[model samples]
Target chain A: MTTSKNTDMDPTAEPEEAAIAPETQPREVATIEQRAAAAGERGAAAVADAIEQGEDAEKAVGVLYLGIDLGTSRTSVSASNGQRETIASYVGYPKDAVSQKLLKKRVLFGQEALDKRLALNFFRPLEHGVLKSSEEGTPEYEDNLRAAKDLISEVIRRAKPRKDELIYAVIGVPAQVSINNKQAVLDAARESVDSVMLCSEPFSVAYGLDMLDDVLVIDIGAGTTDLCRMHGTMPEDADQITITFAGDYIDNKLAEYIRETYPEAQFSIEMIRKIKERYASVADEVDKVVVDLPVNGKPTSFDLTDGLRAACQTIVGPMVDGLSTLVSTFDPEFQDRLKNRVLLAGGGSQIKGLDLAIEREMATRLGGGKVMRCEEPMYGGAGGALKVAHDMPAEFWEKLK
Target chain B: MTEMTTAKAPAASALSVAQMLHLMRMEVDNAKLHGYAICCLMIGLDEFQTQAEREARRWLMPAIFSELKAITFQQHIRGLGLTREHFILAVFPHIGVKQATELSEELLAKARELELPGITGGTPVTISVGVGHNSHPRSDELETLIEDAETGLNLARSGGGDRWMQWRTVEDELEDIRGELDEQIREMRELGPGEESDAVASWGHALVRKIVDAFAVVEPSASLNQVRSDVLAIVSSEVDRWRDLATIRQLSEREKTIDLLERRITKLTGSLDQTESELKRIASLKAIDTGISSIYSTVQGLLDGEDNTEAKREMLKDIFEANLALRQ
Candidate 1:
């Protein structure tokens, strides 16, 4: 199943060595012919299993598995067909006939929708890593529901599933998402795939890296930061923590700082979001973050280095607090182990020197701790979900279908 | 009856006079298509008092033809041939009435310079030329133009043998107005930028007044209200057509922007796909565990192994149970 042996590294090794060890591991020595032969055998075995379960031979020939991380700011997918894709969580419809004719499309997705938002009825369907509207049958709810369905279809289409293949997907959502929201997600995905499942975002990140035991996963997403503690079994609600101090929180903070310091500096939330993504850091020393903002219709440069650092630093305290809660609540014997094997992941974790900053915070608050950033923070959740999809038994998929 | 023999004219270059006339007809038609003027000149020798004098002049005809051909070539005119024993015809295309008149006079002067041998003494040959000019010839006007030149030739011969005359028609007077109008339009176009609007306005007012005056004169019975309405309708339609053209230009600009956006989107999408593939390749190179293989198989394989089997089984069971609850 391609389990990650990163957690099996020496406990006494330097944190840097431990972090770099996983990437420098020697590749498996299987030849192309050997891998192909093994894959063929697996395919045959799956076919036999499917046939034994009373499925048609044609349906058993191919199955396309997908793992999806449905985040508030972005949606990502990892497909068994060696396809990976991510897009901004935006969808739009042309506002009028003129716009429709000019755009030559009835609907637009992601950045295209965002770019031509003035001519479109734009919707960002998810907030706090869940469907924005929970009240069923409302216009807003229906609109968000439709947008989410279209987004799921788009992400699935990007996977390029063949016509002959049966599609099974596992989606990773926020750890503490309500039942109704999970159902909403399931409802959206059902229209696009034959079978689907939902799992916690932090759990998926941990499982993707094979850190299922005595590891703490902090998935810092745009809408919410999910911290889930794994102890060799499925994490219940008690094992998870969700916080609002994530990417969007940083953007709002930075915007507030800019408004207070440079009152005349004109900027939109979208611009602030882009600026935060580009220059976000919690470190003391960072390059001067000079950004151009229009004042009286003219571009003016404003140095936002301190304001940005302050904004980015805001998420760290809440994140470590969540970590501290998970660590304190764990068994006494494994409390230090959980703190040492912390896995920092998701889009918000891409902030420069974030792991070290979190480690520093942990040292001050919890004596000493290690924070390891996942190599592909943006894709970690999706990759883990895909692994879950692949590992799911055929009967479970069939029953879901 | 004596049989008439077809004589090849020196200007016709071995072609019979009939063939030369056919070629002239074709050239006239071509000139009409291009809105060019065609001028026909008919030159005849002065009347001979005696048969012996006429015979002597007849022998000098080829030399006279050669001199006229040289003059035509020098003036860049072509399509010259002999139509009768006493007459030489020359066709010039793209020449205006004034230029053709000058050329006819030149031909007459050049012909008078020739001295031929006579019974009494060396007498200078005298000739008269008739010019027919059509500034905008129609395809069927070739025969009429030739007849007009013939009439002028007869008139010249009747008046004086050594003079030249032009056959003018009502069209020639209209040609003056056409030339003036074209010049005014060109001048208006060439006016300085700031002066253009005023010039165009004045020109438009004059044109509208001219049209109203023409309607009043041409249709005395028509009501003034009807005429005013007709003029208004014409102006409105022209304005509407210009407005439509402007709208089309705006639409075209918008379409270009749309096309640019579509191209940018396609390029970005391609680059994104490439980056994803590259990341995957890098992951594979680093032997990063993607966990793509099925865990069901992994669990079954681990059943015989002794490496954390109980914990692995319990973890798998937990994942299954959670997924089951979600699906249900």
Candidate 2:
């Protein structure tokens, strides 16, 4: 029988670097081609191992792996077929007969739904990073369930899976999603994929980056900021936290400041969102934020730099406070390692100067620290989830299916 | 006589003219943001060089600086500065003009009350005070903030020494802004008993009112951008529907009003675009756009020794446990 290593070992075991601990050294360089070849070799080896373990090896050939980050604002997917897609997580149905006739479609998705919302019954199925599971038997709850299913199916369809291929998906969820919520997500995803598993969003990010240990992952999505500390092991309940102070909160705060400062100007949440996405920062010298809103039916310009900065700064204190708690409570030997490997992921992580701000806070609050921004803020979770789907063994897939 | 070169706590704590200017500029933003008030007070000892003895000036200067610094400790002052014969004090989180005036009077009283040895009687070493504060924080009247203080000082000195005066801007800025808004509303209303422009006027009035209502609550939770965009969407759709109606009938009056309303709508949309570009400019200040792409298409094992696999798996299990614990 073929056996694979399953014991804790130094990740950096190459003889040239044997003396250095894995967490202290930079990751080894592997070219894209090299990594791909290794992955292909591993895939074949894993299949052979499965066969020896009395599993069906032939069933794996046409199986596709999908990693999905189902978020409140946007749903992103990275698939084995080399397709990555992100869409606004919204679904809309025609409001009435006349509008239905005009739109010529029963339902719309993403930006289309957002644009045509006036004539459609718009639904955002997820809120704060979970399926909006309302009280059962209520129409609102049923509608949310339907919307959630439709949204998942639509996102899968966007992956362009071949009809002959079996689909296996791993979805990244909030670190502390309820069991009922996970079941609801699994139920929604099962309709479209052959097998599915849910993983913590931050864990998925860490897995994707190959920083599985001695790292603190902060995935700041629209609805929540999830913090996870990895110590060469999967993070435990004590190693994670989910705070609601995130992108959505920043948007609301920015909008509020604009409203108060320019009482004669008219604006909307979408506009405020644009402001947050484009101009959000917590730095000493960010450029001026000036935008125009209609006033007395005339366009008037107002500077919003102060308000945007203030709103953006709101998350820093809370996030650093959370980071302090996570860092202080870790094994004292690994606490410094955890602080030094702070990883920023998710859409909210795209806010400018946030990594530096967090790092600065960490130094003051935790004695000293380091923070690294994920190369892909928008797709970090989705990419990590995809990695999870790929790493999952064939037997787990079969069992889950 | 107080020693001129002697460093007292308040005068020693004083920043340079440059530093004080910088601090005032920084605090102006905070004052504007939190809806508080700030004012700069410029006090000049009236013609000290020509009036007092060169030896007397050394002791007199420190006495003047000391008293000025002492007054700031009594008020909500942010910083105090000395430039030659003049002293500038910046007061912040200001209560109002009345409080500022009372504080200014106290400062003047304290200056005249100073016990100077070189000069006697006739309100020895009289000082002229000038104060300037803004009612609206958004106004960039900062360049003239110091100038206003200077002007008020000039007025105080000209109107005889030992007195203080507050500068009143020649034009009422808030009133001017209101007048401009009213004028625009009047012009839009003048579009006259027509359907398209009237609808535009109605939406316009409603939009303005909504903006006004937004000012009542400045909570970060309130999303004014959403309200603005929603109103714009409605107005734009209405304008589109009206344009189609006018196009089909070719009613001259309807077309004319539609044209006028369309221009207004275009103007409104143009401002949003300008605002977007402005926001973009701010965004460009940071390294935000260069999002890094991950190289790994699939999950790869850690670069660990063979012996560590079990520990790695154990960690993964712990993560699952933490995640699962949420259900519990």
Best candidate, lDDT: 1
Per-residue accuracy of model 1 over B195-265 as CA lDDT, tens digit each: 33344455556666777776766646548768777886796566556555655666676567657655655
Q: Each model's TM-score, in the order given?
A: 0.52, 0.50
Global Cα RMSD, each model: 35.8, 31.4
Q: What lDDT score is found at residue A211 in candidate 2? A: 83
Give the DockQ-based CAPRI class for model 2. Answer: incorrect
**Candidate 2's residue-wise lDDT over B269-289, tens digit each?**
565555446445544644333
Residue pairs clashing, model 1: none
Estimate the lDDT of model 2. Answer: 0.68
Q: Looking at model 1 chain A, report the run of 10 residues with the lowest lDDT sum.
A: A1-10
The per-residue C-alpha lDDT of model 2 at residue A366 equals: 90
Which candidate comes out best when scored by DockQ? 2
